[model samples]
Target: MGALMLKEIRSFLNSITGYLVIVVYLLINSFLLWMFPGVFNILEGSYASIDSLFLVSPWVFMFLIPAITMRMFADEKKAGTMELLLTRPVTDMQIVLSKFSAGFILVLFSILPTLIYYVSVYQLGNPVGNIDNGGAFGSYIGLLFLGASYVSIGVFASSLTENQIVAFLIGVFLCLFMYIGFEQMSELNLFGNADLFILSMGISEHYTSMSRGVLDSRDMLYFISLIVFFSLATRLVIQSRKW
Candidate 1:
């Protein structure tokens, strides 16, 4: 698993596509957090917190992750390497997991540099180090989990088809639905308690909750379940190819 993960990481680092994705992800994040003259811009806000940037990131990630993961499994299958890969000693689950982790870690690295924003905000506050360190830390955790959820969803989508475009579209749709669709659906009161159940299952709820500096075990468990469910589903999809 470690070797496979390393191979994935090396491949990503060596590829132009990977570099482009990382650059765009970080660039857009910078714009939203520092440059753009909007809510995310600290200059115009009541308090120059990084909260607006964190709040808007989910939407950006909805597109960015799929663009990054579109080639993970889909390109492998398209190039006919998947069959040879399946013949290797690794299990389907290992392949899925290693690829997922590689993609996830790459994104993590992109996010790490954004900590400069936190530091800058800390320094700029009324008193040096006056920022909500706890909330900022919790928000970073929330972002990681949210990005991990996207990675899982992207992996599952990639496993569904050999066409990267198809994978990308499937990933975007599922990501959107998981992140926000359920929450919106619940507001219609169509399912009553059922709506509540579905709403609670959405990623945005837990993500937003965590971003607010309150880390609930319920939210943590939800993200964990989401990652496990999608990883296993991807493995199952690959395993079925033998039939």
Candidate 2:
């Protein structure tokens, strides 16, 4: 499992695609945080916070993660490498796990560079380091969970199809739905008491909650369950090849 994990990690890092994903994610966020003259801009606000980056990155990962992981299993199957992998001593679950870990790590790496934003904000605080350290720290944790969940969805989507593009599209739409669809559903008055409950079920709700420096157990469970569910789905999808 560790060996497969390393190989998958190496393949992503060795290829231009990995760097491209990181670069694009960073570039987009940097532009929005620094250059864009919109509501999210810090310059327009009275304080300096990386709140903008965190807010927008969830949406960004909705697309970037899928694009990055779409090929993990899809290309392997398309190139006949998946069968070759199966011939080894690894089980379908291990293969899925290895790829999932690799993809999630890559996604984590892509977000880590944004820590510079955190440091800068801390230093730039009027009273120097007056920023909400707790909130910022919690927000970072929330971001990691969000990225991890997104990567799992990517792995699951990739396992379902040999066409990488289709995998990417499927992953993006599914993630978007989980991230916002439930929350949006709550906007309607139909559910009444159930409305807020359903909205809290979405990834965004939990993510936003954690961003406020409140580490709720329910939120953590939501994140873990998401990762596990998608990983299990990916394993099953690959096992179906035997049928």
Highest-scoring model, TM-score = 1
TM-score per model over all chains = 0.97, 0.96
Ten contiguous residues minimizing lDDT sum, candidate 2: 39-48
Q: In candidate 2, which residue pairs get closer than 3 Å at backbone N, Cα or C atoms, i.e. clash?
A: none
Cand. 2 TM to true fold: 0.96
Per-residue lDDT over 158-208 for candidate 2, one digit per residue giving the tens place of the 0 to 100 score: 988899999999999999999999988999888989998999879989999
lDDT, candidates in the order shown: 0.89, 0.90
Clashes of 1: 0
